[model samples]
Target: MGIKGLTKLIGDNAPRAINTNEIHSLFGRKIAIDASMCIYQLLVAVRVGADNLTNDEGEVTSHLNGLFYRTIRLLEIGIKPVYVFDGAPPTMKSGELTKRAEAKKAAEEAAKKAREEGDLEMAEKFSRRVNRVTPAMIDSCKRLVRAMGVPAVEAPCEAEAQCAELVKNGDLFATASEDMDSLTFGTSRLIRYLWAGTASTASKKGIKPTEFALDVVLQDLDLTLPQFIDLCILCGCDYVDGIKGVGVVKALNLIRKHGDLQKVVDTLKKEKSYTVPDPYPVEVLRQMFVEPIVTPAKDVVLKWKRPDVNAIKKLMIEENQFDSAKIENGIKRLLAAKQKTSQVRVDSFFKRATAPNEAERAAKRKAVAETNKKSKKSKTQKSSTSTKGRAAKAKKDVT
Candidate 1:
């Protein structure tokens, strides 16, 4: 849903954009989490044979279960999490939202067909695709997050954009989300796999938890902030439809060569046959990403209070029907984590996570690159031999 193929584009063009950091290294950092994204993840994770975890009366409670434990886990490790919820979809993003709704409908039908055919596995697969983070789910997640002492903030616009605003205001260090939208929204540091030791939406694709610094990405790709936003739009974003055939690489090249969207459109007109959107809404889409409407930096208040043990218990055990002992155990963990981070000797709770080691990380990256290079070379040699053998056989046939 983020700028399509933006991750791949960054990997290919801006290697310096990425920095590998372990979950343990983030022991005491304040991270702004995309709450709705995590709820969608739980819908996929805490399921019973493709169906969600539900309380009595057929109400979905997987999100509650997931947030309760995951929030505990974050606190246990010394990370101060501020869960940010999406406010309203921008007018420009209505089209993308509509497309997602239709896709969910199609997935629902496909899931039904799979179930009728006795393909439980396929049914579950399609069902996961169909599952959405409903309004009820969002409210429940916020309730659980706040009960755990984490601040739950509802953004005036996109959650990622608000998280970016928080980071810029120095209220938080980074935005932790599965999608590259945080970077597009101008988050200074975008951390994928915040829960990688547990999971991100990226965990489904086996993506490693990595960090992307916007400044580094811009410097490495030689792109201005505006140019980066334009490139994202050309590649397709949630706000506007992209050109039919212009992919990430093409978008990057166009932005690099022409300087802006107007010039890119003019050149595409003269140069080649490319299908641009009819009502491109270039300025509208660009502004949406470039200068998103977020709650004013000062107006947003983030406070991590003491975990309300009784409030958490009432929701998890009474309302949601979670195991009483398990809910209590999680609370104990939250308390223990506050006193002292589980695996580290930290003097303070709020600033517990340790910074990453640059030297060791760079060395490990070099070794990985070398190993991959060797593996690729080996495959190419084997492919060359196979081709030669096929050619020799073809010659003998001719003879």
Candidate 2:
């Protein structure tokens, strides 16, 4: 669903762009999480015999349970997560949406058949495909996220795009999601495997979370942002069908050669080896990726407040039948975490550890001065391409 095969392709091709990061290393970081994506994963993961975890009222609580625990864990570790919920989907995604709906329906039928045949495993597998994030589920999650003192944004369109906008606007440090499409949306940093499972479980399973840097990717691939978008399209995105028979490597080669989607399409027409979709909607898809619809930066407000324990209790305990003692313990832990983080910020911690002493600084300055006295620096001396500058470019208007 997410620019199919793009994650593996990037890992294989752009090593500089990706790095394994310790969770504690991200202390005091603000990350924007794709709520819908997380909820879908949670629904799949926390299941009870092909059905979701539900309360006495027969309403699903898996999403809430997973989100509550995950968000708390992230916060306790000093990583402030901003949950971004998807609003309306893009019109360009109609084809993909329709296909998904059809697939879900088929899975439901198959699951029914399998259950009748007493193939529980097969039924469970197919039943997962039937899971969809409903509006009510999203609303409940947003409420829960807010109750936990996390900021929540209802993205105007795709949550990935909105998260990207936040990163560019300096509202967040990264986009946390399993989807590679976050790169296509222009998030400066994309975090993977953070929400794949519980931290202990992930550690035991050897699942290390990684952060992807887009600037390094662009620099390494020797492609402009537009060209990179074209490359992703070629690799197959939800918006448009990619050229038949063209793979990730071939797509990269084509984009590097032809320069853009239109040019690539033109070349494909001449070469019968690859089949392009009839009436290929290149311009529309390009527009969707290039200038995705997002809430205006001025209108967006992200504020992380103190966790309202009473509100959380009301939602999780009084309403959803979550154990009162467990909820109370979670609140205490969240408060303790907040207190600890408040006393020691990540920046201060890093500065204390890494900053040079007076003697060392003086020696470094003397060495630099002597080197500069004898050196003729080139104007073209390459500086490292970085994802860090995206923050300093933040406008004065937005809070």
Candidate 3:
């Protein structure tokens, strides 16, 4: 859905461009999140076996549960989350839109068949595939977010594009999305896997969230941003078909050899085995990625304030039938995150300049030292194991 093979290409070729860090390290940070992606993730995760989270009226509450809990987790960890929702799709994306709709229809049919066969697990999986973020769900999320005093932005087009814009404009510290195309959108910082669950959960599962910087990737690949976008198009993007026989590796080679899209197309034409699409909208797609429509920087307002407890309780408890104890605990945690800092300001949602007192600074320094010491020990153990394996292999060869 995102630049088709971009993530894999980067993973295999430029591993050092990715950075891994803990949730605790992101305290006092403001991140712009792709709201639709989070909703879809939550809807699927809340569905277990043959049961979907629903209230007494039989309306699905999975989306609400996921959104509420995940947002609370972010707040509890001292991270301010700005949710961004998508608007009208770009005209060029009509083909991709049709493809997604067809896939959803197929998934729905498969789920029905699985249910008829009493295969609950497969049915559940397929059901999740058919999950769509509906208008009602979006409204509910918006209400919940407002009640929690968090900011929500409605993007002019793609949410990822808007999030990237926010990061570029310095309105947000980073953009949080799983989409690889966010990188192509030129977001300075992109954090992956911050949806449906807490970052700590990912860490515990040994699948830590990765933070990607646009500059680092550019440095590693030695390509300008415009050239990188061309490389993505060559690999395959939402708007265009990839050249036949050209995978991510070949695409990168072509881009590296030829600095421009026109040149790349010319090179492909010379090759007897491949053909470029006639009148390919390659330039249009490149421009769309480079200059996506987004809300003006000055129009965005990020503010955090005391949550409306009674309103949140009514929506979750009386309407959605969520556990009172759990909701209360989440609210308590939000309050705890607030108490850690001296001032919570509306204008500076993404920045905190408070200087730590001597005692707090000393404790932080000690904690950092311990962490570094443990890291050193872990590296030493791995090195020792590698040396021992090589020695054993040598002895076997001698024998």
Candidate 4:
């Protein structure tokens, strides 16, 4: 869906460049998340043996469940998340959408065939790929997020583009999405594998989320941001076809030598097998990547408030038939975390208020040491004077 083979390209070419850390390491950070991506991931990952979360009316609720719990987990760990939703798709994305629909159809057929053959493993694998986020699912997710007091944004175009814009404007610390396209969208930092840590079982023990800083990636690739986008395009972007016989490594090398996309196109034109597009809208794609429509910074309001537990219970437990015990337990955890964070802030405030400044404390200690030294000197001098007088009186008695 992003630049095809882009993640692999970074792994192979610039190994040891991206940052990797535990999920909790993002504490106290404000992250702009691509909600659509998260929803798709949750829908795919939450299934158990072809069974997903559904309510009384047989409506799928996996997206809501994932969003609710995931947001709670983020809050418990002190992460402030702003969920950005996708609005209308850009005209260029129409082709990508069609391709995805066809792929999902093929996956569905493959899953059916696998099920008929009694190959459960293969069927499950195919089924995961076929899962899609629906409009109803989006609405449910938004409702859940609102009840939890997190910001939910409707982006003008791609959610990742808006996230990138927020990060660039300093409204967010980074963008969270699995798609490597966030990098091309000019996000200063991108987070991946956020859902990888949901399980603590032995099989999922080694999986952890990773962070990628754009500056480090660019430094490792020896290219500017624009050049990196061009490299991604050459590797293959969703908007256009790439030249035949050109791959990621080859693209990087060409970009390194040519310095720009136009130069790279001119060089590739001379090749016998490589055929550049006639009306290559590579420029247009670049423009979209660099600057996309997004909500202005002035309009964005991010404030964390107390979770509406009654509303959450009514929606998830009463209406949707989610386990009441689980919801209540989660609510308790949210309350506990809120109190704990508040207590921490109060403790920190008093500690700072009562604690003396290092410089003043040092000066007081120095003065006390000097006074002790002067008193000790006076005692020794008095003792010597008394001893001399006693000796003088004894000499006079001997005379």
Candidate 5:
């Protein structure tokens, strides 16, 4: 909200916005990913291209193919991605999921109805195209991810929120998610376009060469971490649907002046007779954004531990009928790359581990110090200018 220009750049080309050179700097970075989010994206892509993806056994291979290729790419890039999967849907989000399920059910029913009306081909196509996230499917994917040596965490609630909490606490350098709500959730680093390949180049203008620090954002918005949450609510985040007639620009302006949600709500209510709709219950939003379930802290071990080539080959080539030559080449290339660049030093991965809560507090203190310094300098300059202006006025009066 503080920078409309940056948001526009992101929208223009999310993948191309990130510079590859910057990625090298993050070679050893611990990236916490919302596993469900990534899997959902893959699922959608695969479902759309279902006709083209099949194994020798004539079984659909879209999910497995996407997982293998993407995981390989991430490992090749030297990113230590810890994937957090959703354990169970949050109580508040049940309505959203139920709504989706109802939509899918209606679609299926319509397809069936169409079949009865003699539209058999269309019905068959629609039946094959429905995307569902089942418990069994989630478990299967988790096993695959673990097999690939990516640490997988099962989050009790919102996976993205838990990942954000990890980033906030410095256990993770950034939370990789498409949602900008991570910023409001108080992640020190929220990286979009993480899996975009060359598409990250598009984010070059929006993001600085170095990671965009949370302190920089807070200063730019003239708000605290909590106030930033309020601003996001104003901008229509999930916790609270944004206020009517408030866009990004308007939301930023309101929050910068008021510095809190209640004040902003009161100001708008007085000015526009806006009976502020409670976006969600205040408690719910607070809990969702301010407090997230964090996994126990542990020392990060960053290494390009080789994949089990024999197992991968067995799964992809022997069972799935993947091109044996291609699988062999990919494995060979991965091993060679690992050998060429074996050691990586992650800045945040230290010998000692700190509790997630302690790390967050430390981050907050550092942010506050930087903010205070900036504010003090601004105040000093203003006061100095005021004194000079008064002295000049007195001299003019004496003359």
Candidate 6:
């Protein structure tokens, strides 16, 4: 279930719902973060009461501020975060993208018309809004993240799926995302309420927030990982959008009875007499869920580098016109956490270095570099071969 549904079900009692003590027991664990998801939350939250946040030179500072603060919080919690950014979205998501573009275009036009009609206030309000995710903006965020010592993964398509795969393979403990879709996507651990403790909330005795554990979900559904994927398809997901009239409850029941999707489909056709036009081409969804790209060399590390306090103060207090005190406090908290984490990492590194000899270390380094070189060469060769094949096919078509 998504956050909306889960929140509704638990209400104020949500916090008491999950064993946070046990969850924190898994602290210092590596988390594969859906970077775009966190970015979206930052954008929306920061822009809630304003159209745009401008820096001293009148540049947009909303995205930057959001990225800066949230990243600090994640690091403060002692969680090693591997940020995964979206690349070109998969082909099936084109329709959703097109709809988003149209909506943005319509809003822009309305804003323009409001300005022409002398409705300055409305025009200004609409003009300050933004939702489109651009390649350039994503690149800028990636650069900032890298400079901060956060390792980033460039996912070919769905970042959440790749993150989920990382967790499944035990490379990561969990995938951190606000979107509950990660559960359906096959992540073993999906922790919601990541920002729970730091933020304010109304007290409701006996109510607890919950982190929907995958094992519990799987046991409840009585389905294996692949079977759960089948169930999600029934419940409607990005690949299928959804089946008409089939919701979470009904989808669960359908899957439980049929044992698998094909049988479920056959039963629907025969018993219900419903012609289910292939919900989505199964092959496409399979390709979409292909194994994530994993780095063979785990040299990549996440460390908390100290924030440039003067730079942050200038950006937040002077430029953005935020309260100086709040900005200072936030920076102080961030710096303290950074110092602690850095010391731990440094100590661990030196300890490991002391254990290995110079010759052994050199040999290990050489082997890794050669392996990476071979991988790159093979990828280039494959790309060249594919291009030649396409050219040959075009020539034959011309004939």
Q: Which number leads on lDDT?
A: 2
* Cα lDDT of model 2 by residue, 166-276, tens digit: 998876789999989999988888998888734447767877679998877876676777888888988988888777799899899888777788988888889867778
lDDT of each: 0.82, 0.83, 0.82, 0.80, 0.64, 0.62
Q: Model 5 over residues 1-399: C-alpha lDDT tens digits?
A: 122233542333233323334555666667887777676656556544224366776665566666766666666666677887876655666655666678878877877787889887777566654566567557656666665556777777777777776776667778887666666667776676665541234355444223444555654444667876776666665444556677777777787687677777767777764556754465566666777655434533333345677777777778778798887887776565454344567554466433234356558768999999999999999999999999999999999
What is candidate 2's local distance difference test score? Answer: 0.83
Query: Can you tell me which runs of candidate 3 are displaced by over 4 Å?
Result: 196-203, 270-272, 341-399
Arranged by TM-score with the best first, the candidates are 2, 1, 3, 4, 5, 6
- Model 3: lDDT to the true structure: 0.82
lDDT of 4 by residue, 222-300 (tens): 6767788888888877788777788887888889888888788887788777888776776787887777777776677
lDDT of 6 at 332: 72
User: In terms of lDDT, which candidate is stronger, 1 or 6?
Assistant: 1
lDDT agreement of model 6 with the native? 0.62
TM-score of each: 0.83, 0.84, 0.82, 0.81, 0.68, 0.66
Write down the lDDT that model 5 would get. 0.64
Instruction: Give me the runs in candidate 2 sitting further than 4 Å from their true place.
Output: 197-200, 341-399
| lDDT value, candidate 4, whole model | 0.80
- Candidate 1, residue 53: the lDDT equals 86
List model 3 lDDT by residue over 1-399, tens digit each: 888788878878777778887765777778999998888888777776656788999888898887877787787777788999999989888988899999999999999999999998898888888877788888889888888778888998999999988888887889999888899998888899766338335665866557887776765676777888899888887787788899899888888888878798887889899988776876687888988888877888877777888989989898999999998987787667655532344545455443343456457767999999999999999999999999999999999
RMSD of candidates 1 onward, in order: 11.4, 14.5, 12.9, 18.0, 7.8, 20.1
lDDT of 1 by residue, 59-162 (tens): 99988887877777777767888999999888878888899999999999999999999999999999998887888888878887888777899998899999
Candidate 2 local Cα displacement, residue 277, angstroms: 0.9
Task: Tell me the deviation in Å of residue 217 in model 2.
Answer: 0.6
